[model samples]
Structures are given as C-alpha cells and as structure tokens.
Target: MRFLGFCLSMLPIPVIQQAGLALDRHLGDKAFEAQLEELWSAISTANDLVSKVSTLEEAIQEIAKTIEASPTLEAKTSEFIASLGSNQKEFSVLTENQSYQELRSSIVHADISNFVAIGGSTNVIQNSTVNSERTHLHATDNSKNFVDGTTFQGSGGAVSMRKITTQGQISVQGSGIGFGGEGGIGFGGGSSISFGGNSNEVSGNCPSCNELLRMDKRELHKYIHVQCHKCKSTFPFKLPNA
Candidate 1:
C-alpha cells in the first residue's frame, strides 16, 4: 500500500490564517479526513486489481463510469489514478507469453564477396525460436525457407544472385554440401550467405585447349547436358571444382 502523499489544495485561499474556517464548520474533521481516505483507498485498490487481471478493459472502464457519474473532483481523481495503476499490470499479463534471451556467441568475420543477394524483399521476422511455441527460426534452418513457410520472395536468396569476377570465370566443385554460388565466399566482406544444395551453373575456358572446363554439385550426376562451345565436343568428367 503505497501512500500517495497529501496534495495541498492548488486553489489560492487567503493565506492569513484559516480562510476555510467557515467551510470547516460545515464538514467536521472526522468526516473530511474519512472521505479523503475512502476516495484514495478505492482508487489505489482499483489500480492494483487492474494490473493483475488478464483483461482490464471491462473492469477499469466500469470504475471510470462509476467515477464519471459521481459529481465531484475527488471521485474522478480516484478513478483516473486507479486506471493508470491497473493498466501497468494488465499489459504485463498480456505479454506474459513473450520471452527474452541474450544469445552468447562470438561474432564471425569472413569475406563474402562471391555470394550475391537475390532480387526482391526479404522476410522481416519479429522473433524466431527453434522447436518452440512460436514456430521457426529464419535462415538458420534452411536458406530456402522464407517468411511464414513460403517460398522465396522472387527467388530471394544468395541462390539467385551471382557475382562476376572482373576477369575470371565463376568456378564450381561438386563435393561436401553441394555447391551453387559460394555462400559468403567473396573477395572481402563478412556477410552470411546460404546457397542451394544443387545449383546448375557451369563454366569453361574458350578455345584454349590448355584451359580448363569445370562443373560442380548436381552437375556431378551422370550425363551432364553442358551447353558449352569450347568443352566439346562434350567432354565427360567428374570432380572439376574439386
């Protein structure tokens, strides 16, 4: 029970002595003090109750209506104060389901120039959890997954974009975790990237017999339909990017 200290009346009465002596005669000491305490107590109690309740709209509003119908400032003040207190508690209850945690891990610094961000807007996740009540964690689970379990927003991921070297061909090698465009494999920049498991991108040097031709990932599957001019007469091989 926090005591709301007495507020001196803001109205400027004659400061000489006791200007309200006449009015004091009207309301006896016991009656005035008791009435003030009653109003204060009611307001404070309402405030406490509202905060604890799951739903405060009905209860607080009822108190407000009761105060409005009353024809005095003291009653209105009590109701307003009660409403304020109750609201703090009420909203706290509503957000009880929410959780907060600080993940403890070291930051990563890596070069990610090779990776490209695909076209279109990305998912804006307010919060994410793994196997928790909410639903899913974005990016961590799969590069393919986007907002609300929907497909990419216009192929919206590193899988769609590819960076062209100033004067070098894009290379690939079919090995661990497959390949597409290296996620976060740039000349310099530590941006997190995730590529598809099997991307169909092929490359080869033109006309230079001594030059190299290469393919990786799903291309490793037998009988590659390579649409390249220099590599052929259609040369068949395995583990080029390797």
Candidate 2:
C-alpha cells in the first residue's frame, strides 16, 4: 500500500494528470470524483510522504467501499486502482495482497477536525470562549457532566445553545466520554447536540451559587461579564482545559 503511495507521489506531473484523467473517466460517479479530487489534491501538495501515504491509503479504502456497493463498478474500480501504480504487476500486488484488503476493512472513519472532536475524560472546561462555528458536542458512557456547577446526568442528555455568557465552570468525570466546545458547556451521558451561531442558547449556572443565570443573546461575542443573582458573584467564561 505504501509502495503505491511512493509511486503515485513520485510520478511526473504529466503521468499523474494522465492517471487522474483515466480514473475520472472510469470512476466518474459524483462521490468517487469528489474523493479523487481530494486524493489528487493531497498527493500534489503533500510535504510528508508518510502522512500523505497514510491518508491516501485510508481514502483508497473508502473509495473501494463505495465501489463495493455497486458490483458493476468492480472493473472500473480495478482500472482506477491500476492507474495508481506504475504497472500491472504493482496493481496486482495492491489488489491481491491480503494485508491491503484487511487494511481497508479495518479503517474506522472518524472525522474530527477543529470543527469537531470526540473523546473521554475527567476534565474541566472553564474561562473560555466557543466562537460562532458549526460545532457538535457529545458526552457519553455514564459520565457526570457539571456545567457551571449545575449537574446534568443520565442518558440522552444534551444542551444546544447559540451563545453562552458565563462566570461558570464545567467538569466531566467517571466511566464515560465527554466532548467540549468553544462557547458553552454540555454535560450528559448519551446526548449529542450542535453548539454555535445564530441559534437558541442554554443558560449557565453561577459558580458561586449554582443558580441558573439566564443569558442575553445581545451579549454574544463579548467577554464574560456575568452576574449571579443568587450569590451576587461576577466572573468570566473560559474554554476547556484553559
């Protein structure tokens, strides 16, 4: 599989374009085309062959799965795979190799970018900001979620908020997973929700009194200068691990 990456990366620009054109002709489905465009883009710009190869290999596996869904595309898929290698022999090595097939099956497609995150932890999110972005947050696996000193527990728990202005803190712990975002905090065991921008918001609790402090949407994008009615305390909001 790596040898395939080396060959593909080292190919002349002309040959690479030829190969891309060949795949585009055969693997012309919209999905495959999008994947190919990304693959070629990565190949052309990749500075680290190791990382590039790793990423491309996963991409190839995904393309294979798409092809697998349409048995009629098998021949075209073969041709596309062949175009990746230098010759028929290399193509056979890629197609006939047991490890290569196993590698494809083993891929777990978890896409986490700055806009997304997933994990488990005993942690705190405090004194931070979650800017207006498309962010999804999840907390799972029987964990305790403490947002602004208010506890949200049990399964299927989620809080969706556009903006959060708080002088509060969030803590996640126990045998579960917790995902944090930029602006607000969510505590739960099985719920997942989108958090950010031009939507309704969930209020926070005062760190000193654990009283719900409703927020004003007008306060969005400003530094935290929240007042707690119960304890008469004022403080700022911080991001996870800040």
- Stretches off by above 4 angstroms in model 2 are 1-198, 239-242
**For candidate 1, what is the lDDT?**
0.27
Model 1 lDDT tens row, 54-172: 44444444444444555674544633332222211101000011111111111111111111112211222111111111111112112222211111111122211222111111211
RMSD each, Å: 29.7, 21.6
Per-candidate Cα lDDT values, in order, are 0.27, 0.33
Tell me the deviation in Å of residue 108 in model 2. 58
The segments of candidate 1 whose C-alpha lies over 4 angstroms from its true place after superposition are 1-191, 194-208, 222-232, 240-242
Residue 85 in model 2: shift from native, Å? 82
Q: What are the per-model numbers of colliding residue pairs? A: 6, 11
For 1-242, candidate 2 gives per-residue lDDT tens digits of 33244334433222354444444454556865665555444443433333343466554444434444556454543444444422211110011111111011000111121111112211122222222112223233322111222222222332322222221122222223343433334553334433322222236878886977553232333455665533446788643331
Give me the candidate number with maximum lDDT: 2
Where's the lowest-lDDT run of ten residues in candidate 1? Answer: 87-96
